[model samples]
Target: TPVNHTFGISGGKQFKVGADNNPLSFFIVGSHGTNYSYTGELIRNTTSDGTIYQDQQGDKYSQNINQLVLGNINFGINKAHNLAYNFMMVHANNQYVGQYSGKHTESHQDSNDYTGRAIRQQTNDNLLFTHQLISSWKLSNKMKLNAGASYNRIKGLEPDRRENYLSKQDDGTYILTGSNRQKRFFSELKENDINTKVNLQYKLNDEFDNTNSALEIGYNGRFVDDKFEAVEYNFDALSGTFPIDNLQLDDLYNQANYESGKYTMSVGELNTYNVKKNVHSAYAEATYQLTSPLTANVGLRVDNVDMTVNHRVQHVEPGRESIKKTYFLPSLNLKYDLNDKNAIRMGLSKTYTLPQSKEISPYQYVNIGFASQGNPNLKPSDNYNADLKWDYYLSPSELFTVTGFFKHIVNPIGRVDQGNSAGLLSYSNISAFATVAGIEVELRKNLINRVNTATSKVNRVSLGLNASYIYTDLEVDIVNTPRR
Candidate 1:
């Protein structure tokens, strides 16, 4: 037989506004919100086989703020040519806090306990501008073009702390305690993008045969700089003083020493690291309708990525530095409409993931009697993906879709045990390859319609259910050992 218990709480709020003038309009809004929650659990078991027990507890709090402001104005000579422009800004912030604890006791009269805590926060801001020139030009036909550019900036921060304690008793009983603290890391990022596009349409017949197409190209470049720092401490203490009525005095003393001091070894560590990434990309896309039911769409994009890492250490050697080789990415997308109710889509792309800044940091930290260190020689992982998709309309309001995808990864990375160090286990990276395949299914239907009664109309009613499953397989070779 077993027993259990649990508890928790949460809450939040928001606000907004809009205004307009004859030839111009404007909108501005700002909002703030927060949420807090705490949870705890305890379990006890006892039976003919033995006695077992466990307990856990945790709490978290979060807060967020969002703001937006924008306005548009129009002015022109004789109103024949109108000049329109607008500017906008947005920002947000978030934070979190949490803690956990656990314990277990065996029938042999032995027991242990564990505990922990964590916190996190982030912030973001953006600014944008747009200008529109309205004019009609008659060359071979009528044409119009619109161009715009934007700038965005964002900042984020996160920090964390954790402590763990465990204790055991000769009667097979133990006690554990843990504490965690998180500091907000800080991040500053900026982006600039410029774009231009033109649209042309010509009248070809008396029946108003109009053919139209537009071409657009844009460049988006960004620079992101971030800093993260964390500190952690752990300690375990055990005491055994239980009297055994069935055991002799000498045997009790020996068992007490074994039960106590099992976790007297205490360890603490502090770590810090800095990372920056610079990314630049260019893209172009176009679409045309061959006919009413048959349409075609195509798009192409190219991306360039560069990243650098620097690490600082505490209570250890100075951290090392790592630079990632620049990477290039290209992608393609194609889609065709078979009918008003069906479509086919296909895509191919190349992508790369830079090593996590912390992974390349030469900093070393200790945890649970184990020490962890980053390898500065690690390299980025790369991948290639191709996919095909189909969409079908069972009815005007009901639809279903399916997609198949394949992804190939090179230099895949995973942690591998490097061995023990001073009674603590160490781990390092093991590069390998992986293959994945999966299927997706979806179904939707309108089960009921709103009912109108003499006194009042019933609100609209509908029901929906959806589910999906995915599986992955990986093959790897490490230290002459094959793994699957």
Candidate 2:
């Protein structure tokens, strides 16, 4: 059935290399795919008093993708250490083709009604790559160590995006005689991320299960760099011969038109932005069992973040931003076994949410019906969480669970409509605090009866489902500004 919408081919290989004494195992996989998709959309804008109205919409998309993965694992001759390396790359060609037509009828005196059409074509190239290296070693009989590092990068480019509009006249003919009638948009974005971690675990006693006690310590580092730039061009048509019925865009936009004084172009907006983020963290955790039916795990972590942002527009104020934050996060988890088939769990933690690079940049982009801008002064939100859960084991292949949770957040970030304009949107802090509460239920069942041993076995027929109900509360002050 999938063949009707998508066509793809894939293959992989597994091989060994190096000396037989140490022997490295390698794996390689690759795939290619092409897909076509279309979505139906209807956009309507109307006044609250059943008065003015406008409608516009379009949706069409297609893509071609290719991916490759390569990895290798090796064990030392003496089995002292194990190591692995992995790399992956994916590339895609994407395009969106849409013809938008709209009608505006405002219900008011001294107002005029109009209809127009727009031609839209957007094409982009996207690429992603990831690389990782990992190693494990047994320091002693009760201690083990793990270290790993990873790097990833992504790039997106739009060389040319065309959006041309034409308006209808009293004679029932279309002409390009309005602002922003012919436009071209171009943008490029690239992001690089690097992360590294080192962890060590030590056993307190000889036991390895049930009454086992252990301690873990780890160090983590993360670094990110992102850069983005975009430029828009507005074109003006000259006096020349043109086609109206069944118009062809490619032919009409020929370079000869510019040389023949039939088309002129000017820059509209130029936006550029860059971001750098660095985070370092250290953590320690301990797990111990105090009783036969009860176990506890506690952890403490400290994280420090440094971020910088720079954004500039052609004719607007240049933007510069910097932020530094430190967090002391603590977590606790407790589990109690009420019986052989039932258990209870409780968890408490303190966490925070970091702002994405795009969300922290002061950049604005406008489309047909809407315009959006980011906030450079946004702050991260701090969260306090608590949860209680009960789990039931109906059988070796079945499970049921119910959970209740609550969270409180400070300095929550949200999108707000300026109210002055129906299409203007911006991001800011919503309020002082917000509360979220939820309840969840989950179930897992086996459709076929198979092995019922204590060890986990592969199940061919299994089904799982979960559902949740949540309530959220927040408050904000509204601002009124007259639109021009």
The residue-by-residue lDDT of candidate 1 on 336-451, one tens digit each, is 77877888878888787667655666655443223466666676777888888888877766778887888877776665434222222223336565666666766766676555
Best by lDDT: 2
Error of 1 at 239 (Å): 12
Q: Estimate each model's TM-score.
A: 0.57, 0.87
lDDT of 2 by residue, 1-484 (tens): 2232333444444445455566556666666666666765565665434444567665555444444444454445346677888788888887777776666433232134667666778888989899989888889878989999999999999878888777766666777744656888999999999999999989875233653588999999999999999999888854433444687866766799778877788896679999999999999999888677888899999999999999996644897888899999999999999999999999999999887876788777655555567778889999999999999998976899999999999988877655544345667777788899999999998887666577766546888999999999987754653322
Per-candidate Cα lDDT values, in order, are 0.48, 0.78
State the weakest 10-residue window (summed lDDT) of model 2. Answer: 1-10
* Per-candidate count of clashing residue pairs (backbone under 3 Å): 24, 0
What local lDDT does model 1 show for residue 94? Answer: 45
